[model samples]
Target: MFNGLSFEKLLLVGVIAVFLLGPDKLPSYAAKLGRLVRTLRDYANGAKVRMKEEMGPEFDDVDWKKLDPRQYDPRRIIREALLDDAPAAAVPVIKPVSRPEPAYLSRQKDAVPSQAHDDSATPFDSEST
Candidate 1:
């Protein structure tokens, strides 16, 4: 059965097909279409059988509708994960231990004169401009 097509729509399509193909070619085309449908059905069934063989008894237990990719929604999944009943374990908060300043920094601070108290003019390079 067509997913949404009514009998009227199908009849219209059939009428158009008959007009397009004419009486001479319609039977052969119809036979080809039937064969194609049969082949597709066989392929689907073969796949299902192969899956059953590979999966063993678990194949029957699987919820096919639930496993369908069309049901997948990232938003719904994220929301469900967020709304899960069990609370997550609290992470331990660690206060960082105070460390002594590095020797190089202390030495640099002592070596560099404070700019607020310094009266020297900054050197400018005229040629580099």
Candidate 2:
């Protein structure tokens, strides 16, 4: 049931645990860990039971997989968003319109000759004015 952890990683963890705990304490520690896991599992089941009791019959109808954060991936979300069952001809394509230059910039262009326009004059510099 370990989703992300591979067999090699789990084996490495077990080997490290054996080396750190030693042969004498390993069995006792393993027993304690199993008990701890059992206790946590019991707590989770109790919480689920309590939630079902509080939420009534509606909790049974709830979509747990859809609500789960791990169920969503970037690829899945993008795929869902881009999905269109209709024909391509039915979809309208929008063309961008070219906007005219602002009044000040237009006036500046008309007042200044193309050849006389100084390329070295920086727009933002206080010395330019």
Candidate 3:
């Protein structure tokens, strides 16, 4: 939730808070904010546990551990739901396109160089290419 909080933002917030509360009371104010954040986090976690317990089997299929925003995209969820709702036969069947067979050579001369090619032996002909 607070993963987007950066050092710059934090520093700016701290400066604003200090200005509002005054330097003398800044430490106490920061400590109170810290406690509030911790309390909020604890309450959120408790709520999650309570919600899981209340939902029970209804939400048992859901993987709450993977609830991060990156994995819980709305567009992807809608697309998957749409695909799941569609009847199997309703989707068009696609036959995989077959590849053409490779040509086969049966002659030994063809395996070697043609008559137009030089048969002269070179020092490193095998490695040069």
Candidate 4:
């Protein structure tokens, strides 16, 4: 439980506390610290019990590891979304759109522009003017 602190560090802290507080006040401080820890543990237990009671028996059946925030990865989620287990033949093929050639391109330069090219309603074409 004390993964961040080793026994040596704890012993050093205790020795420092003894010197700072003096021997007379150390015992009372230790008692207060113990009570604080006990109270915190009681509160935590009470909260857990209350939560269990409110959530019903289904709470115990939940997969806690699956719900952990550390398991979330945007890259993995997007990769899964783009991938599928179905065979290639099961997927649909989308053909490109075919449009009639504009009259201006096939006719002489002196020829008048067609209504389709002159009209503001004409769709934009990036490859051709």
Candidate 5:
């Protein structure tokens, strides 16, 4: 079932194949392709049958569309989780604990003198410049 291929595209591919393979060998190649498709179909059917046997009757009841990985959207899942109808009171409130500043940061702050109120010109190192 070439669902993705348009009629024009199929025609173009067939024309190209005819030119490349020639009319003499085309029939044999087409037969081989048909057999390959048939074999693949049989293999898929066998796998399905094996899965059905291993899973039992519940396999028939399974929501295959719902189980599809393509149907999962992380954004939708997170939104659903965030908008769940659990009572606000039941949710624990996390309070941020006041922590003492790190020793290095405290020392740095202590080392730097406040210059906000100072009107004096800043001293510059001529050698560094």
Candidate 6:
């Protein structure tokens, strides 16, 4: 957007900033700025790498040769996911059976003696003799 700005205009901006911050502080300030920029660039590159890893090989399938920045809305890519006629994808629909109660259930439930069921007398007992 600032392509029309002349070299003189950039020189003026640099002069003003140097005057405001002073010459001695500029080198140290520039070193810190360079480090900050490197950190941010590294962070962005790491994120891009991680996204490529997570998305698999298809992540690099960008058509850089034909990419149009103006039409790059993410929502446009998923526009058909919510369609009314979206296909009913095939799946194994397990039919649950209403199982009848086992005939021995009542007998098993009443068989455990109260004295033999004391929690302190088992191998996990806290009150072992």
lDDT measured at residue 71 in model 2 versus the true structure, 0 to 100:
75
lDDT of 5 by residue, 54-93 (tens): 9999999999999899989999999999999876676678
Query: Which residue runs of candidate 5 sit more than 4 Å off their true CA positions?
Result: 1-3, 85-129
Query: All candidates' lDDT scores?
Result: 0.84, 0.83, 0.75, 0.83, 0.84, 0.76
Q: Candidate 4: deviation at residue 13, Å?
A: 1.2
User: Candidate 4 at residue 116, lDDT?
Assistant: 30
**Model 6 TM-score?**
0.45
Over 17-129, each residue of candidate 4 has an lDDT whose tens digit, in order, gives 99999999999999999999999999999998998999999889989999998999999998987796666566677898886666655553456656334545555554565
> In candidate 4, residue 74 scores what lDDT?
94
Q: Candidate 2 lDDT, tens digit per residue, 1-129?
A: 679899999999999999999999999999999999999999999999999999999999999988988877999788876896566666677898776666546666677585455766655433344
The TM-score of candidate 5 is 0.62
Q: Highest TM-score: which candidate?
A: 1
Q: Which stretches in model 2 have alpha-carbon errors above 4 Å?
A: 71-129
TM-scores vs. true structure, each candidate: 0.68, 0.51, 0.41, 0.57, 0.62, 0.45
Q: 4 or 5, which is superior by TM-score?
A: 5
RMSD of 5: 11.0
Writing each residue's lDDT as its tens digit, candidate 1 over 47-99 gives: 99999999999999999998889889999999999999897899999999786
Query: Roughly what TM-score does model 4 have, to 2 decimal places?
Result: 0.57
Model 4 scores a C-alpha lDDT of 0.83
